[model samples]
Target chain A: MLKSNPGLALCILIAIGAICFALFSGDPYYVQVVIWVFANAALAVTLRFVLLIGELNIATAAFFGIGAYTTAVASTILGWPFFISLLAAPVIAGVISSLFGWITLRTKGPYFLLISFAFTEIVRLIYTKTEALGGNSGMIGMFPPMELDAYFPAIAISILAAILFGLYAAERSNLGRVFKAIKNNEDIPRSVGLNVIGLKILCLVIASTAVGLVGGVHAYTNSVIAPADFTYFVAVLALAYVKIGGEGHIVGPIIGATILTLAGQFLHSFGPYENIFYGAIIIGALLLVPGGIVGLGVRFKAGTLMGRAGR
Target chain B: MELQVQLLMNTLQIGSVYVLFALGLTLIFGVMKIVNFAHGTFFTAAALVVTSVMMWSVDTIGMPIWFSYLIAFVMALLVVCVIGFVVYFFGFKYVLKDLNGSFILSIGLLLLLNGTYLILYGGVPRSIPAVIPGNITILGASLTIQRLVLMIVAAIITLGLYILVHRTKLGLSLRAVAEDQEAAMLQGIPYRRVALYGFLIGATLAACAGALMATVTPVTTVIGDDFLVKAFIIIIIGGLGSVLGAILGGLLIALIESFGGYYFDPSTATLAMFVLVVILLIVRPQGILGHAEK
Candidate 1:
């Protein structure tokens, strides 16, 4: 498989390099940034995963929050072991997302979009209202065990990279083809005696579970999690990443996430102007480069090949 | 009895603004087939304009409060219309009937406009003096005269929209296009123009709500955003693109908020609304007045 797909091989090599850097680097700041890139790429990939079924799932943010909160509650409140607490994130997020998808998947297109948006907001409201979850101030103290302290960043990056690879693998499988068919027309898939809604729920569960794991890693990485952190805006940014990266393939979102996350570091000092910059970027990409950066690259390569043939 | 009357009055007051806001949202959705996530920005623009215009007219020019407010209200509507026209031409026109594209475009507009509002107006919440002061008692329920006027104006605007939609030639074209764009175009109706009109009318309704809301509450850069979530819920429950549904949904949500908030806490009331939405989705996913999806 690695011999056939050089792209996958390169990705694995990069992941190993990132993990090695995290393990060996003395500077924590750069390691944190690398972790953020992996985490955001996972988010963008998972978001695109659900788009396979033609629904804009804003609840991606909600499930991420759920994962974080589950880990937080398990570790801080229940005093579970580190690995178990982290494992609980995806489990809880997956279960809740299945239920959420069952109720919501019935509504397609704009209805699904609006309902998911509402779900994200309401989930955040629930977090704020529940005092045991730390309310508006949010929860803190999600540290890994001392022995794992230095290795936590490496571990987080590895898991996040694994999520990216796992999702990419799923996208290339038969299940992914079914999801594409559903997006093209659900009735066709249903006519085949397939459970259309069931597949949608599964798709949501897979993406949500991935994001949930990211959220769990995030909780430990940041050592704090807040209700404000999981707003519908999170999904919007993920969508931006998907758009900018070019959603034609899995690599687009990763590239988009890496560029934006790093740009975000520089934009931090600009105050409210940061939002304007992102807004401009989103609109510009939509109008000028609807295909995103990857799309542009594809067009360029195609043009050069055509020119050589013409000559 | 008095407490019930007070609650009823509160419901009507809140419901009126919601009806106007949701009507615009539904109307735009009906015509363009795109959700305008930046609809709240129209509301924000109007409220911000009202605040500035009121302050300039009253504080600087020393105009009388009521007259100054009338000018501010008109100015607010005008400014929102202009903004709507610019956005419709520059952005929304291209994304017509494209839901995801339009959603992203509107969000970009939301971030850009909101950021500009923050820079221009600062983060402080500003409130104007009540244009009409004093209180009145009706059925043993006391309400300020200003709030009473706000409700009256909102009701008048809502009724005017109802008449325009039902009785006018323009309204006929709007309904025609919304019902079936291709069929309407076959009938020689200009789909794009009608869509522009529908979008402007929707923005104006939001402007009306924002202008009225500024009279009662502090106008912040983000005041309009507070209504966005609830307005979405109202539109969803009422059914997308249904004017009457928006009206009914708005009133129904306000009724729930008023009574539920009174009975339980405000957060519980919000949770109750979400629960109600889930139940509604299970029963009638198309909404109470919405047509079944194709």
Candidate 2:
């Protein structure tokens, strides 16, 4: 089933569902959460770009933080409009991602992981240390959408869904196949005379922008921004969702994000148990269900139980 | 001159502590080829163990200050090793063959441990018993005896680790496992036993570092985050799967942090270490002591 490449059909379904939900849901909180899911999905799928290329770039949170902080600073400190900050957020994240790619992508394996992880820490530290970004306490008083019209939720979610759909489409295209090749066999890609580094940088930039846009929406929704929301925890959640849902498929992150977000929010009363549960889920998924929930379905249909068990 | 000496000592002390932290991380990577993010959680658990010992005062044994530390280290090591063993057996064992799968599993373990720490210890930072009596002034430079002892202990541990790696049969097996697990198994080396030993050693070193660091920085749920970051930097700058690289990386980062903290802002100093590491990684992707092995 996964071999058929159902990405386009999945995106259309998601788009229709998002619009319908916005149109019918009376509760603003519910609508807001949908927006949040979209934002997270976009970020997660974009993050898949690097992962698809076999790079464990764990700095999505950093780029997201940059976008969120940029929006906050641009809106409050510079008194820019929400729209302006939204546009600038991705640019800021993209620039930072470019610099990061230049310094990082040169290494392989755990070294590369460390480089990206350290980069996130630096971003977080800077976010916490700088008074301009609101220091350890984080920033507040972010500008909300200028027009809180009834269509805001629908429009925002639509735009997010569209951008995410674009990303999903791009990944399925010829360009994405090249990335998959690079991930599977780095030397093969290089041997074929592909500019591997350039492709990585391009993907990083594009993915960074997608994540940044989500961060921008995050800021506007809350009308406040802080370091805590854009943290390693968020990064973990995004990555976990991608892995648990199925990293190889676009719908995987979407499904993963929705389940985790809703579960995390509703079952939050269990306190830290949620984290433990989340951890267990990821580990279990990796160990017993490497193909994720979707992969399991595919395996079951084919009657390949053992194949399903292994990645 | 005195201040400079004091700074040098401080740098060495911090660097040594970092070395201790990175030692376990490097070992696990070296032997099992597993990047254990849960490594930091072991340190956190150790810090908590130290705190619990100070607060509860397990009176059945009744030992001296140094003996209590030894007991604390031992107790923490046992707890973390058991945890590590279970995680490795359940989550990591099967996933070990796949680097990506293992990476995700370790991260999950990290989250579980962090959550566990928060649940068991609370988010509040707890203090450990400061057993060292006083400070010693040498050539007009003042230093806490505990700090001095911790530094010595770190050096001793480093030397011991070096000896264990280079001088022992277990060390040879470890090197063998790291170089090629399949080949090592073909040579009749007990791969699992070596890996268990590696996990035990990693857990012990991490706990030891945590116990020592708790004396200086106290114990908190978030301590793992800071130490994890530092360890990552050390492992990267020093070189992945390289024991000596971890040592050198730890010291280099420590000196940079020490001097940077004084000369520049604390935040900038931290940033400097990462920036320098990133530059170094870009220049030599294999790290200072790391040789790319196929």
Candidate 3:
């Protein structure tokens, strides 16, 4: 029943549409936007993976920054190829995440969150203040991929969609069942003799690697890597995207990124009003639709349509 | 010796401001699990209120400096408290019912309040005219009377808060609610009312700090972001809910920034403080004052 679901059909349609939109837009400016949306979506999905285990790591931005800078510095200074730098980016980020998780995994809830945030701030501060790197003036003149001639946006979106679906499928598989069990009752997962710490750390590494990939692409696409781009606000925005779109499923990040990007474009001229709009949407969603749009759809079907059909 | 004295004074002044701000944040966090991202927005709002009032008094009405400061403080406090109450009722009610639910909602409120400030006030740093005219030398250290006044006011407020929390009936109720909300609700404490009071008190504290800070530093819409980070840092360092711990944490951060900046690069100093927070968490996650359960 699960293998032959209508949701899978919907997912495929959405993926195709997204890929088509990216390819056809043909605007250079829109290409940059696509890169940003995919990068953030990847990070949001990573956030979702951890959130499933009831944890919020506020350092996703820091890791993203780390990956971006690592790639930027390697390409700019060492004259490495884009693909090689991209490959190294996640390894660097994953190493940092592993060290951070080693220290912070024992602390629970808000304290854990605060410490992670501090870690992010430290990375940003180091990036900004180190004159040897760039100081407050920021890193400039990054190089983009040489191989890709056209349809970069489509490529990026397709890659991101592929990653999202990959993660979603993994979550639905037998391995995914372990993640659900861990989320349901952490102690029960432990009592069942599951390797909880190993599983969580593995998730963190995987998420960091995903973010690192996006960061590398972004660094190359933007031709710049500044400390300002990777602040606590970035992390919060990623979390917000996940929360507003829906935490329980992978499509939520896509929906969230799409909605926010569109909303941002429309309200771009309004300055802070855009944020107020974003915030209001978040608050309304949390209050009225805790399960998010997907959850709302489920409730509608179960409460009205399904009940009526039964009658 | 003179340089040492100057650094000490600067550290003390900045430390006091942070202590006041972080203490306010801790109070709310203690009672409500909500992070109150809007906590620092109140600081900015209060600063704006202080700035506008002081501007009107001096620039428009030509009032005395002393009177201007007093009026600014009161008006700012009143305005922020009202905002706090409104936030508690409108934004917080839903979030507080479910921890995860409110976190997202509060985040939205953070963006909204920040945007509101940006829209109302242009994104520029505006300073409050100093009330005291000149500096006075004390114990071989020259200090501005305005800085001294700020320190004194901060101390008095902190002490007043300490007494209020430990000695009063309302403070006791606040504590009860913080300890266990449902149990406190069972005692006919009216949890929502107490939560509102907590919000008001926290808002008032943060506002007062903002007003006081305006005298020392210029006010900008984005300044709240800096204060929010500092407050979150302090709350973590001092532990979540402990009053005494917040005071120590504030001072500790202040001293770290002061000495670290003096010894190393300013950026490195900031990074060090954050690194220390991570180290401290691994060593003792509960912080200087927080209990194990928290």
TM-score leader: 1
On a 0 to 1 TM-score scale, where does candidate 3 land against the true structure?
A: 0.93
Better of 1 and 3 by TM-score: 1
TM-score of chain A of each: 0.97, 0.92, 0.89
* Candidate 1: tens digits of C-alpha lDDT, residues A1-311: 89999989999999999999999999999999999999999999999999999889999999999999999999999999999999999999999999999898989888999999999999999999999999999999999999999899999999999999999989999999999999999999999899999999999999999999999999999989999999999999999999999988999999999999999999999988999999999998887777788987897978853343310
Candidate 3: residue pairs that collide: B95-B102
In angstroms, the error of model 1 at B232 is 0.9
Per-prediction DockQ: 0.79, 0.78, 0.66
Question: What tens digits encode model 2's per-residue C-alpha lDDT throughout A35-83?
Answer: 8888878777877777888877778888888888888888888988768
lDDT of 3 at B211: 90
C-alpha lDDT of candidate 1 relative to the true structure? 0.94
What is the lDDT of every predicted structure here? 0.94, 0.81, 0.79
lDDT of 2 by residue, B7-95 (tens): 89988899888998898989988887878888888888888888787565535556676678777777777777787778777776676
lDDT of 3 by residue, B40-96 (tens): 788888989999899999999999988988999999999998888888777786666
Tell me, what's the RMSD of every candidate?
2.2, 2.6, 3.0
Give the residue spans of candidate 2 off by over 4 A: A1-7, A306-311, B58-64
Give the interface RMSD of each candidate. Answer: 0.6, 1.4, 1.6
Residue pair clashes in candidate 2:
none
DockQ of 2: 0.78
Models 1 onward score TM values of 0.98, 0.94, 0.93
Q: For model 3, what is the alpha-carbon lDDT of residue A5? A: 86
